[model samples]
Target: MTIAIIGAGVAGLSAASDLKGAGHEVVLFDKGRGAGGRLSTRRASTPAGDLRFDHGAQFFTARDTVFRALVSDLETRSHVAKWTPSRVSLAHTGGTWSAEPLRSDDDWFVGAPSMNSLVKGMAEGHDVRWGERAIALSIRDEGRYVQLDTSGWQGPFDAVILAIPAEQTRELLADTSPVLASEAAASVTAPCWAVMLAFDAPIKTGWDVAEVSNSPLSLVVRNSSKPGRGNDETFVLHATPEWTRANVDKDKEKVAEELSGVFCQMTGAGAPSLAAAHRWLYAKTETPANSPYGWDHAQRIGIVGDWRIAPRIEAAWQSGHALAAILID
Candidate 1:
């Protein structure tokens, strides 16, 4: 069967790989410039060599036997690496910073070069169409397909997978699958504002990763310390969900200025050499997914994503794998 998977994220790419291994043809589409979805990365060139930043997910843990094996294989292939940063949770309560006790003990893993590398490796040897935004969904000739915003309708596929975020999925599949659309619409994923800062001079920040609380900023990560990043004092700051929603509409420069100032105060990193901001409308999940994945056998429409399971990189891969397994079976 030919499968048209939307969103070249981990989940969608995972589904495409498994289904192809089972002797099925798979075609993938993504609105983004490349794959990996929230498993994103940013690269910049400065006088201090090239710099990299994982602006989306900082790190992920492997728990499931399947996922553990997958990550191990990636590690063996040098596609991913173990990250053990000096992490501490900080309470910014009362406008002061206090180090709190660590919470989780699980080891974190990140892409070797950047988070997107993991997914890019997964998408290798696949017919992936980038910059293909699905504008609408339709069904005809007893098959389902999506109408690209740029390229008109392309279809007659055996299956269509909605592997994008919940909100985008809801908007795309509202007519084809109303029930799933409603569920997608009901799911709550919070927005986030991420700032990537590159510094020319080294700063004396003792820790590599700091999770902040009771403040507008959420987490501060020293990007240079990652496994395969440049030696510049690069940092990434993530805003809290509440703060992101409140200021999501603000201009990027304005938000960057505000957060860069807060980061300098928090870490004493001094003024950034260069800084950029990005807005993720659906950054993280606020609620857990009740279902691992959704499949309508009659409609031949499947839905899988991190939002379809627990919020994490593993869940997203599992969700897509589950849906593809069911379909292939």
Candidate 2:
């Protein structure tokens, strides 16, 4: 079977890997410069030296068996490791706390080196085309199936999987499937502003990360504290959803500055040597689907993502792997 899966994120890659393992020819496409959609990582040069920071999706938790199995396998391969972060909350002043990493089970793992490495492992040898943004979809041969961005009608493909955000999947298949489009419209996502910063000196905080509330900042993490990061002082700061929404239309630099200021205040830190901000328009979903996965029209065109279950990497993995099991069956 020939399959086309959109979005090379965790969900997409998981689906592709499973399909490939099932002996199906798969073509995965992503609009980004590389894989790992929200599982992103970036390198920065600070006064201290070069640093690698993961500003998107600091870490993931597992809540499903399929995702747990995948994590166990990743653990064996050394693709992931346990991450223990000192956790703090903003609900109090001069108060601090700590806890274990969020996990589907007792064991939790982070991608070795960075979160992006997980996507790279899933993308080992699949036909992935980066930088190809799918524009539209057209059904050929009278209700057989659809092809993306073209109308020549070459395929009554065995399957088509949309592993992206619901809105994007809706946009691509809007004209062809009204019911699906309407369902997607009902599941909207929230935005986020992730700021990556690098400091010249080591952070003085006793905790590795802090969860902030009632402020512009939502979470602040020491990037160097993660498993595979070197001795550089890098930080990842996330803006509150309300803050991100309020400042979404502002200039990128201005938004970064505002968030950076809030971060400095929260941590009692000074200006960073380097800073950058990324805005995720549909970053996190406000609501989630009732089911762990979605299938459509003879199981030929299925959709899956974190939005299908819950807004987390575990949800995405579960959705993808569950869909793969259904397909294989």
Candidate 3:
């Protein structure tokens, strides 16, 4: 069978890998210049030097056996590592976020160099057509196809699999498949404002990570504190979903200044002289479908992503894995 998979992220690539291994011809497309979607790493050019941040996904935890085994294998191959951060709380909810002597135990894992590295490793041998954003969907000559922005339609495939973000999936298929696209549109995802900063001097924030509230900052972490990264005094801050949604339409400069200010206030660190901000419209899932994946065998269409009931990198993998399993069956 010839299959067309959209989005070269973990979920899409996972499905493509298994589909091809099962003897199906598969073609994958991603809007990104590289694979790994939100499983991304941002490299900032600073006068001090190049600072890399796992800006998209801070860290991922595995609670499923299949995912655990996958992580273990990645670890054995040196693609991933365990991160035991010296976690801390705000201590005072309303007041300043000076870190106190409070710590919590958690098992956080990060990709060896960056979170995207793991996905890139997983996509080692797959043929992913990059920068091919699917702009529309259609069925012609009784075969499924997606039209790319520049290249036009790409398929007459036995099946079309949408592994992109739910909102994007909805936008692409809204006209051709209203019911399916409407379902995709119904999945709720939160926007996030991520600020990446490189400090001239080492930071004095007492803790490496903090869960903050009552302020614009939602989560703040010293990226330099993570494994493998040199002690470069780098930090990444995530704005609360509420704040991000409200300011989602603001200009990048305004967004960066405001978010960096809140980060300074929360961490008690000085205003960063160097900084950048990114907005993720589908940053996190607030509500998702009850099913792990969706497939319409008759229509030769499948939708698989992390927009299911469980919203995590693991869930995204599970969604794609389930899609491939169903097709093979």
Candidate 4:
């Protein structure tokens, strides 16, 4: 069977890998320049030197057996590694900041060189059309088809799987399947404002990761503390969803200034040599679709994403893995 999977993220890549391994012809289409989706990295050049940041997702944990096995395989292949960082929680009260150790038993993993390396490794040997946004989906006398912004309609496939965000899935499925579209609409996601800071020298901090409260920042990570990252002192700060939504329309430069100030205040760090901000309209999932995946077997159309189950990276893999199993059956 010829299958077309849209969105080359973990979920889409997971499904494509499984379906293709099962002897089905599978192709993936993504709007991004490459794969990775939320598991992304940003590289910047600074006067100090070159720096990289895992700006999208800091790290992922594998709670599921299947996902753990996959992570183990990637680790063996040198595409992934375990990240052991000192974690702490910061709180502000009466204009005073206090820090406490944040402990977790879960094993945290990150891509070897960058967060996107995991997805890029998964995307190997697959026909993925990058920068090709899927604009529409149609049902014809022949079979299901997808319309791309640049390439027009490409299809007659046995099935079409949507592995994109919920809002985008709704837009594509509104005409193809109203029921599925409504399901997609029910899922909710929140925006985020991320600030990447590059320092000439390492900041004096005992903890590598900090969860902040009573501030505009939610997470602050020393990106250089991760495995395989260089000696550059880079940090990634994620603003709270509420803060991001409130200042969604603010200028990027202003956002960077504001967040950098908050980071300095929280960490007692000096001004960064380089600071940049990235806005994610749909950064984190708030309300999921309450299902592993949505499959309209009669129409041979399905939807899978982290929003279909949980917001974790493992959930994205599980959703796609489960959906592909159903399709293969």
User: Which one wins on lDDT?
Assistant: 4
The C-alpha TM-scores of every prediction are: 0.95, 0.89, 0.93, 0.98
Clashing pairs in 3: none
Q: Candidate 3: worst 10 consecutive residues by lDDT? A: 96-105
Please write out the lDDT profile of model 1 over residues 88-195, one tens digit for every residue.
887877877787556467879989888888897788889999999998877888687789888888887988998989998888888898878887887899999999
RMSD (Cα, Å) for all candidates, in order, is: 1.5, 3.3, 2.0, 0.9
For model 4, where is the 10-residue window of minimal lDDT? 45-54
Q: Measured by C-alpha RMSD in angstroms, how accurate is candidate 3?
A: 2.0
Q: Write the per-residue lDDT of candidate 4 for residues 1-329, one digit (tens) a residue.
A: 99999999999988998999999999899999986678888889877677888999889998988889889999999889999999999999999989999888899999989999999888889999999999999899999999999999999999999999999999999989888899999999999999999988789989999999999999999999999899988999999999999999999999999999988887788999999999988889999987899999778899999999888888899999999999899
Residue 281 lDDT, candidate 4, scale 0-100: 89
Where does candidate 2 clash, by residue pair? 62-104, 63-104
State candidate 1's TM-score. Answer: 0.95
Model 3 alpha-carbon drift over 4 Å, by segment: 91-94, 98-106
lDDT of 2 by residue, 1-329 (tens): 78877788888888888878999888876878886688877776655666777878888876567677777777788777788777666543454323334323344467888898888777878888887666755555543344434333334567778888988878866776676666677787888999888787887877787777667877888888989898778888888789888888888788878888877766678888888888988888888777766677744577889888778888787778888888887
Q: After superposition, which runs of candidate 2 have C-alpha atoms over 4 Å from their true positions?
A: 47-49, 92-106, 142-156
List the candidate 1 regions with Cα displacement exceeding 4 Å: 101-103
Lowest summed lDDT across 10 adjacent residues in model 2 is found at: 96-105
Where does candidate 4 stray beyond 4 Å? none
lDDT of prediction 1? 0.86
